[model samples]
Target: MTDPGAYPNPGQHPTPHEQPPRTRRRRWPWLVIGVPVLLFGACGVAVVTSVAGGNDTTVTPGPAAGDTDGGAPDRGPDFPGKLDHDTAAAAGATITRDELAYTVSPLEAVDTVLGSYLCSTVTIDNVGTTQNDFNGYTDWSLQDTGGAIRDATFGPDRPMLNSGQIAPGGRATGSVCFDDRTGATPGTYVVLFEDTFSLSTDRLAWINAL
Candidate 1:
């Protein structure tokens, strides 16, 4: 307190501990800064994000590239072949084409079955010793309710048919399909078997579907 002329002899700068007070910082500088700019940028980003989301929703339209057009699929060719016959005969021979003779068991149906279309089959026997040589015929004819005469055609083929192997007196039945009428309908069918060797014909059976 008594040092009149005793200032530190030379110019020594103030020590760090005795530095001057700092100027007061203004808080409004932050408010005046880029806050509005940042908010505007955020709004722009949100708009862009929404637009991108909408585009993502419509990324691909309709079906994928390999989608089927729902049109008719390709149909392969129809089968061109004959039917399989139950040729579980004595010899393990499968009867095919003209050589085939088919049969159905005798089935007695009621009036309703007779009135509708049906398939009638009967047993065909192989009676002869040797296998059949040429063709033999079993002619079938029908008399309907209206007195109309219809050929109970063989194999639904042309008139009388040829069978390759109906051994000598062999018997094999062929299918004759037609509607059997009710008793009131009045119908008749006769099956007659004929071969070249036999002058006499063999009458297999007569049936009335009605």
Candidate 2:
């Protein structure tokens, strides 16, 4: 027979089997912390991959210095010097600017309905390998001794300078007239010629004095 004392009271202390299962320690807390950690690690890996890919980007270069669509390199005018009467007569008042060569004859007086006008024969030769344009109305001007400037005008009795494209090594000639509103003599003016389409701002000039 077992003594009554040998078995404890059923309610005094519970056996392991009788105790409520250790409440599982709420493992959901660990799952929640671990899931966020795993997600953050994945995002870190994605950022690293994106940064690595950015290093392989390519860049294109621009056109080289002095490069042009035309075969010849573009250049400014090479002025020989300003020409006066004797030198102009000997040299024909010639000047080369960029790809064009200009020649001007001595000025002569012409009668016009508006007023007296100074006229000259103007010639242009395309010395470059590429074609170039010329506009007589806009490219020619006359400056008098009094520093007054006048643009080229039409002379009814004279053939006007033809404005158009000039092929390489080709030349054109015609008359350019400017109104003499100041009554200045023909030889007391300066003839100016420039290329309207050229990148250079220089003007070729000749003194009309004889």
Candidate 3:
């Protein structure tokens, strides 16, 4: 082997003015590389958030859990009967006094001699094969509807036509009257009578002029 200190060294200490060689890697190379990737990820998230935030939201009504409207509504204090307006009106009518019908006839307009009340009469004829049902009870009235219903009266509109009973095959005449000669104007009146069942006579009068 050569003398220990005698072999020339690849590099020696430089002069006072000379510079030393640099290492290949930087001290903070990971930070410089990672910063760009982190910035790109942050920028992507911001863009997505902005796009979503720019939209407007609206409220919408969702479906009910079950179908409740399909059924009938609760109707209290039945006016005449259990049947609705269409069903009750569609039922057939009769003339002469029968056990199932009443003999209703139209009469001349009679002013309530008692007072301002005016009454229009309609003769009833229960032309059915049975005996008259209106015997002893007075449950007669007219569904006199041409305008708005006059809820104002002595009592309910029901009592307006309820009068003395008529026998079967026997003719009974009914008079529809409104008190004070008011509210009820000139129009069509449906003479309704029910002894066992119900019967109505279509007779109209110019009872009260508007």
Candidate 4:
């Protein structure tokens, strides 16, 4: 009513309580900064977990590659038996104990004798001037690893080599049988030969592989 046309437009002037447009509050800047901080925090937690687990873990060791059960090999048939001889006689075929040259064959399998018997060809050469007497069955016997003894020529089985006499420089060759009836297991058996004259002298001359 009082000269309204001369007054300014109300829409053009902002009131004291009316604020300016906020310019969308720049949401992209906050998103970029906050996203990077969140990613850094996640990576830091993962690195810390890995390092802590590495220190707590324990590594165990294994046995040496070449270690064994800690035991000595058993003495067996392959081992050569003992011989009583001087240094001079050791090299020659003649044994000093009896002044004889003897050769024995490897044990043979035979089913003729009772139970189980091992046969072999034995040759004894009298290297001395005097005669040598031998009772193959009585003089030779089987001795197992347990030291159990079994007599030879049991029942009617004749000794392949019998009690006989040999002249000087004479060689006698024949088969000898050994009985394995002592229930001793087959391992290393010491074939002991004894001189009738010297009963105390028993020589472990051969080993039966069995």
Q: Estimate the TM-score of every prediction.
A: 0.29, 0.53, 0.31, 0.48
Question: Which residue window of length 10 is worst by lDDT in model 3?
Answer: 57-66
Q: Which residue ranges in model 2 land beyond 4 Å of their true spot?
A: 1-91
Q: Please identify model 1 stretches exceeding 4 Å from their true place.
A: 1-118, 133-138, 145-148, 154-162, 166-174, 178-188, 191-198
Give candidate 4 misplaced runs (Cα > 4 Å): 1-96, 154-159, 181-184
Give the per-residue lDDT of model 2 (tens digit) for 1-210: 889999889788776799776655678889989999999999988866644432221111221122335654322222234332111122145555556667788788887776788888988888889998888788888777666678999876888996898999999889999886657653456777755654344455666663
- Please, what's the RMSD in Å of model 3? 27.7
**In TM-score terms, which candidate is top?**
2
Per-residue lDDT tens digits for candidate 3, residues 68-169, read 256543221123323331112211222222223322333224344454543444455544455443322334344544433322123222233344544545
Q: What local lDDT does model 1 show for residue 131?
A: 69
Candidate 1 residue-wise lDDT, 40-94, digit = tens: 9999888666444211111011211123347522111111121121111111111
Rank candidates by TM-score, best first.
2, 4, 3, 1
| TM-score preference between candidates 1 and 2, better one | 2
Given candidate 3, what's the lDDT at residue 173?
51
Distance from true location, Cα of 160 in model 4, Å: 0.9
List model 4 lDDT by residue over 117-196, tens digit each.
66666777787789977777777765566666656654235347777898998988777776654444667665555555
- Model 2 compared with the native: what TM-score? 0.53
lDDT of 4: 0.54
The model with the greater TM-score, 3 or 4, is 4
Candidate achieving the largest lDDT: 2
